[model samples]
Target: MACRCSPLLLPLLGWSALLLAPMLLVQFANAAIFVDDRGVQHTWDESTKARVAVRAGIGAVSLYHMGMREEQLAATWGLWGVRGSDFDPENPSQGSIYPEADPSPEEAAFLASAVNLSPSCWKNPRGCFQWDDTAEVLGMRDEIDFIVNIDNGSAEDSYNAAEEAGMNVIFIDTFYEYNENCRASNYSIIDTSFCYGRSMIDVAQRIEELAVFLGVEVDQNSLNQQKQAACDAAQAFTETMKDLHDKGIRVKVSIVDTELRDDTGVTTASVADFDPIELWVPRTLEELGMPLLHAASYENNEYGYIYSDEYFPDCTPGFVNDTCNGNTYFPVDFWLIDSRSFILIDDNFKLIFPDRAMLAGQYWSYPRNDGSISYVMIESLLNEYRTRLGSAVKLQDSTGTCTPADPKATAHLVADGTGGLGLNEFICYDEAAIQQEYLQCPTVAPVPPVSTPTSPTPPTANPPVPTSPNTSASSDAIMVSTITSIAAAAVTAFLMFCSTSG
Candidate 1:
């Protein structure tokens, strides 16, 4: 796909003190807390909350590459202000930005103020950078922290580039692409990959980070408590999986998303010997057997950004790494052991999160569509399991039998065939569509055996010889008759000549 970044050509400025380190902050009050220049505790405000809500991640990547837009940022802040009560990421058919949508003027003003931290990044035409390896484009920025180093195409090159840039570089190859030189974190680093496993928690921390950097301590006890709660949710989810297995209902993880893997430059997976920061998740179904879904690639080194790889078959190339906007990308290297897609079966024991369009990140893709994110809080995902216990009817096959072509078929869900969510919109997961996807046909009927031909008669070679003898006699008789006729004709010709002369 075509990705562009800030390409302004300017002289490099000396590096500034490393921007706020996330570790300097601690948790408090079960909420986000960060330390500021003044050493005071700070919490996320409405505007900060809004910005962090829609962001899959917050960092140098989006700022440098990925073409992050001001309007989308503003919309995210607006949407964040109305999560849950005012908005539902799970159900998009309802709500607006205000009473639903249209954030209040004061809220709008705050979002605007909060969002313009790097007006220079947007205002300067020179800072726009587009990376298409072979593209003959030369551009630079003035006074940046990181210096980029070049290697033909290796992970070491990325590290070397980061080292040369004089800035701390966290390789997020799973989520976003760093500058080829690996120098700066402008727009490209501003991805929301971090929001995948940890939703509200990331929101709180990201907001606090922004508030502190813009001018700010975020709560230590609160955030600590939240993390603990998140861990609890993870534990609860695993237990629920055990219960489901008892009921013969199972969760088969289809595909692990791209951001859920390690950097292409590093190894695909971690080993006892090394810690690899790729793969967006922790302990996948393949590595650890939880009710968690596992992933298989559409092709070697390629995967669907969508909920399942099956959708990859349906996808046509667009942007987002030449993939269909199923939100699939390179598996992110970092993943939480506990984080998962909330799409699951209801206690009724039927499918819940079945379709890619209804899955998380539907609106938030790399090419960056106008879709908004729903706050699938840790609690909501946990609730999905709790809500599904003994709830749904025994799922039936497409033929209406409990034993579908696939024994795993619990039920069937059909798509409304609406195809996709509207522009800048996302429709919730369609259970019917998901159910329909599982129903399969049993074995095909066997064809009748082919009849064998009887062996050819031994030529009745004698019969063939008898027919040849007759043929030889007929030919001799014909030749003799022809000679006799010729002789008779000559005699008649002489008589005729004599008659004519007389």
Candidate 2:
């Protein structure tokens, strides 16, 4: 007969096994370990004295899920020459060879030179990693005090590395991961939909979860609570980080736009109900006690492309529905407007200095891998602006990629003006280039009075009752022409896409 186990122990053993599985997984998963000064140990090490170099990994869902493989990450940092311990059990591709020192002198000099220009802020403030890694390849470690993993790796791994290196973290909250539209934001855990991606509703939820994970226990409430319990929890968490904050391990949580939580009914609107952007502004102003560095995309057509009646004919129909004639009826690109508006309102808060309200040039600021180019000519234009402005202007390159501020202390701006005095600083070139573009634009100029030949009859004391319906008719006709052109463009676009796809 086969050996038989006790039936009574079956349930007990099963329950014990269920509990042990998570414990075992936790132990195995605790690749990064930390210890405080008193010898207290923590599963994920987040406290350290070494500076952090945050890297935004490339935009690949598969890569993101797999986490940061060692060899892949090593290639990113050029670890072939750098000698150090290679302990990555997860990825075998990592090389044992390591650089004895930092990047080459030429690269360090290049980074040093690049940091002086503004608008070349941090690489991908959102979550794209290519730009982030490029900064490291160029030897920004000497300049950047900390390398917070924007999308450098999984949150756990990133925190672990930061702790191991003794660097602070700039934890960009993920709204879609816990929002009602969790499934909808399929591409990125954090939506890249401007204001929608950074709304407070999503932010509040994300912050609460992050706080709990960071080993804090603030009171939280259900999602639908009329009062903002999530916001409170976030505020509490930020306050609690004070302990680590005192240790010089500061954490900054940012929302790219203010209107993220507002109900704008646009694609860029956040699915979360909380208004974290709005809540963050005042608190960031009052509680954080640090001058808020508010950045926003300006008003313009998507990608700053002039897709007029010339490019997209099908857009005409959409334009027709909005106006009497199609001229002024172009679609507002609500999503773009809302995102820009969110940041614009923040600029309106006079307390925020002009430098703080750095105007992000266009919505799609960076070059897309799929052949999309940046709206503004960054290199040539900014260089010209810097040359013209003299000492009155300061530019800070945000890691020579897509951040709003430079890593070095220099002002990272192409061109900036004095306070609300309505002064416009030139970023591209002298007044001539701007004037030429202004002239070429489609905006109608004010029509001046025509000096027509006088009739033989002397003018009556009161001018004969003017009976020119032509002016009104012309205005109406212009409007109609504009509307028709836009509608035609949009319809043409739709049909073209369909035909091409099919």
Candidate 3:
């Protein structure tokens, strides 16, 4: 049966599953399971360790869900693995997989075995595996309750041996069974999105499934808490987008594989609601034209051909390693794409600093064509815009993906320094005009005089320093440009995936 949840769920409960024995239930109700060094007996068994792991699992699951919520927010600007990113805690696929151990050892030992992973997946599945190989080799495979996975070869032979020894063999292929649906994010009872961030409902159902398999029952209140947390997160995420909308910083997004349709690697909806670019996506096969770069593709030194050594040097371990350089790293192949692009899906997007935010020493900061030195992170950009423009930069109202409906079809939004901004459909984009406006930013101090009154005396005049970037070389005009700046050759957008040993 589907788990029913209450709205007031939070402060998630941390507890072991309630054993389904009627005597155990009576003991729970009567408080009869404890002793004080008296003649009373305490429940002490190797299996009882799963209880401790179960408690820790609650915390791990909560962190994983929170990471998922954060991802939904970050996807707003298409900044997944770049610009101060946080990887999902449950699914350790993003940057550093070394320190992050999601599944508690107890859970790892309870119900599963690890095998040699698919050859394509580095023999280690990121974004996909529930447990890392370390836990598997650490004796987790020695303690399964029942219902273990089966394979056709050596793994199958072992399974047969175990079954002959009176162990029940239950066949399950969860990885392949739910992989496609999970990737597509068709969240439902049957097929749920896995590692990226399992939803509350998804987690609850999973709990129930595990309970059935283990012949245990979960606390209904705990189930409700999980569900409630999901709803609350969804509500909070929606409000975040709405806040962006009122401030006017929402950009519409229409994600596309740039190389497939055009070799130029840039195609436009020609819509102005978003200054969409040609997104750069690394791929395994250039002929297949697949843009989504999976962890599997990076195995076997293939990804290095696309991304340069300067970008993703052999010295740097993770796809991104800030300890080495603050810059986001991808195979050098990402640099060749014509333009960085995205269709803003909603203003509800946000950039979040995860629990590890404090650990991060630095994020990439650099000068842009806009003549401002700023951190390239999404939150940093949004904060800067809000501080300077009095309102967040917003996309023109866009209804959907088609030109008329898409954010791209709409006019570009331009803010007038007089506490106001407007959409410009007639003019494509006035970059120079915008730069000129930045020079006179009311929020950024005050506008400088077009020309200091030509002093009557040279010594007293204090001639303007030519080095000042705010001033022009040929002309003395203080006008700003609304035109878009030149974008990087390609975007560093990437989606990570992982798979467990079958």
lDDT winner: 1
420-467 in candidate 1: lDDT tens per residue? 111112112222322111122123334568999889866554453443
TM-score of each: 0.29, 0.21, 0.26
Ranking by TM-score: 1, 3, 2
All models: lDDT?
0.27, 0.26, 0.23
Q: For model 2, what is the error of residue 190's alpha carbon versus the real structure, in angstroms, after optimal superposition?
A: 15
* Candidate 3: segments with Cα more than 4 A from true spot: 1-143, 147-200, 245-502
Off by over 4 Å in 2: 1-42, 45-52, 55-175, 178-199, 207-306, 310-502
Q: Candidate 3 residues 407-456, lDDT tens each? A: 11112111111110122111112222211211221222234679867758
Worst 10 residues of 1 by lDDT: 269-278
lDDT of candidate 2 over 169-260, digit per residue (tens)? 33432322223222221122332222222222223333333223333322222222312322333333334323322322211112223222
Indicate which candidate wins on TM-score: 1
Whole-model lDDT for model 3 versus the true structure?
Answer: 0.23
Distance from true position, residue 120, model 3, in Å?
21
